[model samples]
Target: MKSKLKMKDEILEYTHKEIENIKESFCKEYEHKIQAVIEEKDKEIHAMQKKFKDLNEENTENKNEIAKLGKMLEDANKKIKKRDMEMYILLDENKKQKEKAAKKMNKVNELLNNLQKEYTDNIP
Candidate 1:
């Protein structure tokens, strides 16, 4: 009976050692998996940041182009207004010259009528 007890004791000791070794190995594997997941998340975050920066640059360029077009439209409108003013001045000048010409024509007609009356009286 003493021999059987000694064999059973040795078996129990061996089982305990095996259980401790399995626990250590499982902990190491769990830590390695957690580190791998962290690395993958870091890479995804970096990619997202780069994409956001590129979109900001594109938005700025579009705003600058719109401003340039607005300035060009303003300049074109100014030119149109200046041309309209010049046309009005030219039309006013033409109207004044027509009035002067009409006055000169009336004077010439009166002189011819007076000459005809004098010649007819001298002949009688």
Candidate 2:
């Protein structure tokens, strides 16, 4: 009876030790899996960060290009205004020349009328 009790005690002790070892191994495997998941998430986060940085850079470049185009547009508008002023000056000069030609035509007509009257008086 004493031998039977001692054998039973030893078996119980061995069973407890095996259960503790299994629990420890399970905890280690769980920690390893959690670490792997965390690393994968970190990689994804870094990739996303890099993509965001590149987009921000591209946006900055686009903004700069837009500013340059705006300056160019402003310069073009100024040139057009200058050309408009030149065209208006030419129109004013044309009007003045036309008036001068009209006055010369009136003087020539008056001289011709006087000449015709004198010739008629002398003939009579």
Candidate 3:
């Protein structure tokens, strides 16, 4: 009876050890799967960060180009204003020249009339 009880105890201990080993193996597999998921997420995050940086660079370049275009537009507007001022000055000068020419023509007509009157008086 004593030998039989010892064998039963050994069998129970062996079964318990096997169960514990199987649980440990399952835990290790779970940990490896979790680590793999974490690595994949890190790679995805890195790619997104690089894309965002590229977009920011592109945005900066666009802003610079817009600023250059605005400066060019301002210069063009100044040139147009200057040209308008010159045109106005030329028109004023033309008006003064016309007035002078009209006055000279009137004086020549008056001189011709006076000469004709003197000749008529002498003939009579």
Candidate 4:
């Protein structure tokens, strides 16, 4: 009866040790799974951050290009205005020259008529 009791005691001890080993293994596996999930999340976060950064860079580039185009348009507008002013000046100069030419032509016609009349009177 004492031997049977000792054998029962040994069996109980073995069972307790087996239970503890199972618990330890379960804890380790749970820790490993949690660590893997954390690593995956870290990778995802980094990827998201990089994507945001790239988008920001693209946005900045687009803004700069827009600004450049706006500046170019402004410059072109200035040139067009300058050209318009120059054209107006040239047109005014041309009008003045035409008036001068018409005056000169009228004077020459009067001189020709006077010369013809003088010659006709001298012959008579």
lDDT of each: 0.86, 0.96, 0.91, 0.98
Residue 104, model 2, lDDT: 92
Give each prediction's root-mean-square deviation over alpha carbons.
4.7, 2.7, 3.4, 2.8
Off by over 4 Å in 3: 1-13, 108-124
Candidate 2 wrongly placed segments (more than 4 Å): 1-13, 116-124
What is the full ranking by TM-score, best candidate first? 2, 4, 3, 1
Q: 1-124 in candidate 4: lDDT tens per residue?
A: 9999999999999999999999999999999999999999999999999999999999999999999999999999999999999999999999999999999999999899999989888995
Q: What is the lDDT of residue 74 in candidate 4?
A: 100
**Of 2 and 3, which scores higher on TM-score?**
2
Which pairs clash (backbone N, Cα, C closer than 3 Å) in model 1? Answer: none
> Which window of 10 residues has the lowest lDDT sum in candidate 1?
105-114
lDDT of 3: 0.91
**lDDT by residue for model 1 (3-114), tens:** 8899898888888888898998898899899889988988888898888899889889988988999998899889888888898898898888888877777777777777
Residue pairs in candidate 3 whose N, alpha carbon or C atoms collide under 3 angstroms = none
Per-model TM against the reference: 0.56, 0.76, 0.70, 0.73
Model 2 lDDT-worst window of ten: 115-124
Q: In candidate 4, which residue ranges exceed 4 Å CA deviation? A: 1-13, 117-124
